[model samples]
Target: MAFFRPGVSREAEVRHHADQEVGKSFGELLEKARGAEHELRRTQASRAGAAELRAAGLAFDRALTDALRAAEAAQRAAFGVKAYDDRIRRRKGVATPEGARWTAEVNKLRTLREENRLTGIARVPRPFAPAR
Candidate 1:
């Protein structure tokens, strides 16, 4: 039988997909934050003048705060969970027919394997197999 296995339900699959999308968005936001941090660091390191260094330091601080706030908001909006909270929960559920089909396919595979008592099947013959 195939290695495919019964998995999450349709509702669960939808929820999982949504969660993934939100995660990607959150990651993008984090990348922006990192860029801001890099800029701030560069400004501070430049030898142009003292005034420039001070300005850069201030901007860096503000950028840091903005990044943190953005992250918090994204997390709450995406997963409906607080950054400080130990546990997070999703507000939505999945609903996809494909999920159901996949689950059924997995169950069928499992049933076939049990009945056949087969470890595995391969198209290519083993080294010890007798030549035709």
Candidate 2:
């Protein structure tokens, strides 16, 4: 016999809608992240000023985080909490192919960030202020 909880169904329905929205956003977020990554690469190759490189890195970080969040949400929605947890445990936090790719990108980003931090070139001017 299933326990009767009137609120449970409503909560599940809301979650379903939220998941749908997240699924829809995954593609857009991924595209934004890709664009940010490209910009960061270009800025690095061009040996841009510290401010520009820092800005690009920050933008890429934000975009990548957003994309990863959306992807995780979609995966959880598709797999359910228990199954998703099991998969994550089995995979060691990389539950899907997209997750693996994102993880690689994150690793690369961290390496670049560390290199810049070591070189003292990741500093940025005040937000919305003119770069010196």
Candidate 3:
């Protein structure tokens, strides 16, 4: 601390006041930097969460498409038609149509959600053997 000397001019007091103001400004800057750091962390976390959701959406979409394809194949095998014809439905009991059964199938490789909704073949699920 600079003691006030009898000879010290008024300029010393002015210098001391200026220094105090500058110190206060530095404290405010420190607070602002801390706030900015906190906000950056929060933004990063939100971005990571969004990325995971996008990945899940992609996974769900792929599973649904695969399921639809499998269900179509099962329907073809069950009803002997690539497309469901009403004539067949009228002749065969409603029980035979592929639409009446399996809503979802979960396997290790892929989740067969749509295939499960497609038809009866899922009910009698045969091990998926690659086409001979």
Candidate 4:
């Protein structure tokens, strides 16, 4: 005989990855990027000294690069989670609403990531990476 625990549903576990881990992390990173961009623009428009402007620009570039890298990681994780959910649905012959929502969310994140990558001017500073 087997007992089913309502608290330990597959959907709950999958939802944690889709919503809590990847989604929240990406959202925070996006917010940070936006803040950095706004600061850069403000500094530029304020007619600050060249040194101040340059410093602000550098800060913004670093923040944007970090955010983009984090977003890429989040996107990859989201894709993996979506694929896992799809596989589970296929194996169980069940289409979960949570899974559908997660797929849509993942697509939205992908779109945002692509748009940011295309429009952003900053490149990750390779010199900052740790040596192997």
Which candidate gets the maximum lDDT versus the true structure?
2
The digit string of per-residue lDDT tens for model 1 on 9-119 reads: 666556445544554454555566456557655765564455555555555445444444444343433443221232322322012343344334335434533432332
Clashing pairs in 3: 98-119, 102-116, 102-117, 103-116, 103-117, 104-116
Best-first order by lDDT: 2, 4, 1, 3
Error of 2 at 47 (Å): 0.4
| Candidate number that wins on TM-score, 2 or 4 | 2
Which pairs in model 2 have colliding backbones? Answer: none
lDDT tens readout by residue for model 4, 33-67: 67876886787678776667656666666665555
Give the count of colliding residue pairs in each prediction.
2, 0, 6, 0
Q: How displaced is residue 8 in candidate 1, in Å?
A: 26
Q: How close is candidate 4 to the true structure, as a TM-score?
A: 0.44
Instruction: Report lDDT (Cα) of residue 121, candidate 3.
Output: 18
In the order shown, the candidates' Cα RMSDs to the true structure are 23.6, 7.0, 35.4, 8.7
Query: In model 1, what are the clashing residue pairs, if there are any?
Result: 11-94, 15-94
Best-matching candidate per TM-score: 2
> How does residue 100 of candidate 3 score in lDDT?
41
lDDT of 2 by residue, 1-132 (tens): 999743424555567568667867878987997898799889999999988988888887777777766765665455443333254443654556754665565465456445544553367656696669
Q: Residue 124's C-alpha lDDT in candidate 3?
A: 32
Q: Would you estimate the TM-scores of all the predictions? A: 0.34, 0.58, 0.31, 0.44
Q: Give the local distance difference test score of model 3.
A: 0.39
Error of 2 at 105 (Å): 11
